[model samples]
Target: MAERNNNEFEGKQKNIQILYEKFVILNRDLLNFGVSIEELKEICFKRRKTVHTVQGSQKNAQHSSFIVAVTVVCAVLISILLKIIFDSIIKNTLGTRCLLPNNYFIWEATRPETNCSMCEDVNSVLVFGNVTRDEFSNYAYSSRPMLVKGAALHWPAMKTFTYHFLKEIYQNVEGAYESIEEECQILTFKTEFRSLEDVFAMPESRVLLEEGEKPWYVGWSNCHPDVLAIMREHYTIPHFLPEDAEHAHMDYIFIGYQQGAVMHIDYISRLMWQAQLRGHKTWKLVPPPDCDHICSGISFRVDPGDIVLVDTRQWYHDTHIDAGEMSLTVSSEYG
Candidate 1:
């Protein structure tokens, strides 16, 4: 009887333990579900804040983009308006020539006092005197243009290459005159009957002369220092840069003649002081103007002993010759 009772009690105790385990599992599941709900609410709140921040940023970006577009449009419009205004003003100012007397007809010098009387009377171009040759030859440089009529003369330093080319010309040939082209020959302008003193002192030599029964040109060639030295033996001073002209320097003198009613072109570089030794030379000039297309050639006369300088790219000019005589000019290209 006692054994039966103990076995029944043991079975009852096992049932109680099983019920306790079932209750513990249900309680754990409920606690986990509650924690999950709280975590979901926290995530939803954070997402809301993030969405609001993104919306604000998008609105700011749109506003900034609109401002940039407006600024660009305004800038373009202003630029177009300014361009139109500037174009109209320039077209009105420079498009037409004035009827009044053009003052561009002046002597080629700093001062107009030295202009020849014949050159002064006409509306022709005039070349002017410069700082004394002595001043120009030295470092005492002046911006003054030597004048002929009332125009300004310009002088620039000579290039080293020009001197080299001159040396080549001298090294290659011999004679008093050399022909670079059949149409033009390098020659001297010597005159007779003038006092040996003044005649020898100047580089003026007549290029035109009577040969036999016809008037033929006496050609001079390959003018070198030795030839000039020889000529100096007969003449006085030939207005040339001395061998020791500078510390260690030399120069080349190129000769050109303006045929009757010929156009006087400005030089590429360097100021050309053209001395009128024989005959008269008329010049017309237009200062450097818009794009260099419009050429203003004013007429002017240059007389003997009158030095006129054409500053580099100064103007377009021309000359007229007496029926029988050729106009003589000496162009010195200085550095």
Candidate 2:
């Protein structure tokens, strides 16, 4: 009986020893898991008799959760601030442009007030035989729709810019045509081609205006550096523009048969000058929809080498190629 009693006491001592060892390991683990040393001690030593009590441990865990939430919220706020700063820097550094699509910017810009008085006395377009820089600045800079005769006659593009010539250059220029598919804008004015890829992939015989070929007209912006470089070599800014006038970095190219564009206002930034390189295009300029009563609309024909200037942003206009060869025009904006 005495030996049995001694064994029972020894077993109890061993069980308590194992429990104390486990508590020591748990304290070490809690410290590693971000629990404060004080809190760990309170959990372990203050309740040495009640090892299952997790009150201090729970408090530490709650504090840790709060700190994690605050850190996450601070990170989100910091990310938003950085994005705003980056956008402002990009806008200021890159010519104050929003770096968005042209259409997006146009939609954001407020439409200019159309002064019907400007178009009041306009019976016909102001045709300039030889417009000096001063005359152009004063008369046709922004208020009047004018045409400068023979403005682009010296350009090599007058005779050389044909369907095949343009198509070939766009194909040869590295990623020139592909850029349109990716980022550049293309207008399939009255055509079935949904993308530049579809336009370029069309059969050459149909593109050549053969018998009964589907007549198509398409317009696209030449934004690729290499493509613009080659095109600039063929043409240049009109000589009559104001000395300090600034032009857009890119130029618009319109090519194909008749049905140029329906009467509509251009959603561009500033006044535009379009050079008729091939065929004859007639311009019908109308006042804004709101000024139809006070303003007078007029029609004029733009011949090859003639440069037509208009504040297309304010005027509703249309164009239809006169019966002639395929029409091609290159245009850019200035202010």
Candidate 3:
């Protein structure tokens, strides 16, 4: 199955390249109209249009205006097409349909800015029972990852974040359902629960891991401010994070009995910090394609109370929790 997914992903990638070439060919006139290749790639890849001034006769200027209008329309069309194809690639690669977080994008797929030098000689993650802010900051912006043991020792979440406790956290907040219904991202992974509402509405027997119940794993961003506030009341930020690092307004909650997220790169804006409040899990990290020849892939375990910080945007990662215990985690990004 993994091999098949890899082949499919490769095929999709080829298809994207083909489309990109065709787009360039069809819009070859754009270059004459003043569109640089870099700007064209940006338009097709990120849907960000760049303004270019045309120099020539009045008739040429009129033609340039027409071309610009056409380019704008074509950009929107290609963006929608790319979104559909990229989302399909994600579903296939993950073997599950999961929504990318609001801040996540396909931009990382077209271009990865990781410095291979950072991946050099990093055979495994560095570990510490505890670390100070400046000490941790050294690895903050790079591809190097660090594991801090007992980092969540003081977080109330370690004890209080059960299925019921989490359900109540969202339940007590006004308009939580509305927020989920419209905007928040949910990663149901391999589970049948399509939405946060479905997750919460699940029967007790399934949620509690009763005999004969199917295994499941799921996660979602705590987008509602009130819900996030109540959740933050249960845990404080990691003291080891740099004081200058800006915290994201929202955080994510992941919990379930077994299975985990698939291997993928994050296109997030900052470094990620995850506290394993319960159970044990292992992360499989791989370097970006450009660094594959020079860098080595590694795996590491995250036991309960251990906090793992990584610039996930720079690493392709997949994770799976050990079978017996329920896994619970709270993660946030810092810029």
Candidate 4:
């Protein structure tokens, strides 16, 4: 009985020892797994922080680039605008400087107003420059005046010039003034041969002048060569009529101002330079409206040794002269 009791006790002790070893092994394995879990969690948090910082840096770089691009674009646009404005101002200044005659300036004074009494319903107000009256002259080299109303009628000048020119060439007829025997009358009004059509119209129409006892027509029909020859002698360079053999489609153009002439205006002419050889004249200039294309529309007039710069295609103007006065006006054209 005692030995059996002792054997049971030993078995119990061995079983207890085995249980303690198994418990120790299990506890160690549990501790290791927990440590690994904590380390993995720490690594994951660090990686997440690094990734967030990198993303934030990339975003900041993109924002900076956008700002720089915007600044550069703004600067470029402003530069372009300033350049355009400066260029326009320079061009305007240059154009004004270029407005001169033979590279020289010329001008004449206008007639003083006599008693503040404006002339009545001054008809046909616009003055044109570089216009030739050769087609309008009744006689050769005779200056023809253009009639201005609502429209400038150059037909009169053209018609008178053509009739006399044709008669002088084909009919070999002397002009009225040429036939006059009185020297005094010849000096007062002289004549030459030119077709009125040369200044105004086509040479297809026929006009009939009235018989004698009528006043001398303002247009050309006949003129004295001797009187013209005297006038020619005074010119810087004598301008004379060529023989019929020298006639061409485009020939001498007649241009001169009447002693007491009046003109109105609607538009300006290209350019002009005039010199007063004898008489005094007055001019009234109207400035162009800004909305109506001031640069393109302009005209010009002349006074003795005076230059008028006007926009040939624009502005309206007027001119008048006193009695016993004369003026020499030269003109030119441009784009």
lDDT (CA) for every model shown? 0.37, 0.74, 0.80, 0.31
Per residue, candidate 2 scores C-alpha lDDT tens digits across 1-335 of 33554565566556556655755675565566666666544443343221233366887556566444534543454455455555544444343222333333454355666677767777888899877777776764656888999989999999888877887888898898777765568888668888776877889877767887887888888889899999999999888887788888889999877788876677777789999998898888988756778788999998899999998877778888865457899999888
Candidate 2 local accuracy as lDDT?
0.74
Q: Arrange candidates by TM-score, descending.
A: 3, 2, 1, 4
| Model 1 C-alpha lDDT per residue in residues 272-333, reported as the tens digit of each score | 55555455655555433331343333555666556565553444454555546554434444
The per-residue C-alpha lDDT of model 2 at residue 28 equals: 64
Candidate 2 off by > 4 Å? 1-113
Error of model 2, residue 324, in angstroms? 5.1
Q: What would the per-residue lDDT of candidate 4 be over residues 1-335, giving only the tens digit for each residue?
A: 33554565565456556655754564454345342434323333222111112355766555445434433543454455455555544444333422221121121122222221122222323343443334322322211112211111222221233334433442343342333322211111222323332322323231221233111112221234543333333332111121331221111121323332222231222222222332344554443333232222222334443333333232234445543332333222221
Which number leads on lDDT?
Answer: 3
Specify the poorest-scoring 10-residue window by lDDT in model 1: 151-160
**Which candidate ranks first by TM-score, i.e. highest?**
3
What are the models' TM-scores? 0.34, 0.66, 0.69, 0.22
By how many angstroms RMSD does model 2 differ from the true structure?
18.9
Runs off by more than 4 Å, candidate 4: 1-278, 289-303
Best to worst by lDDT, what's the order? 3, 2, 1, 4
**Model 4: residue 78 alpha-carbon error in angstroms:** 58
Could you tell which candidate, 2 or 3, scores higher by TM-score? 3
Q: Where does candidate 1 stray beyond 4 Å?
A: 1-145, 148-223, 230-261, 264-268, 288-296
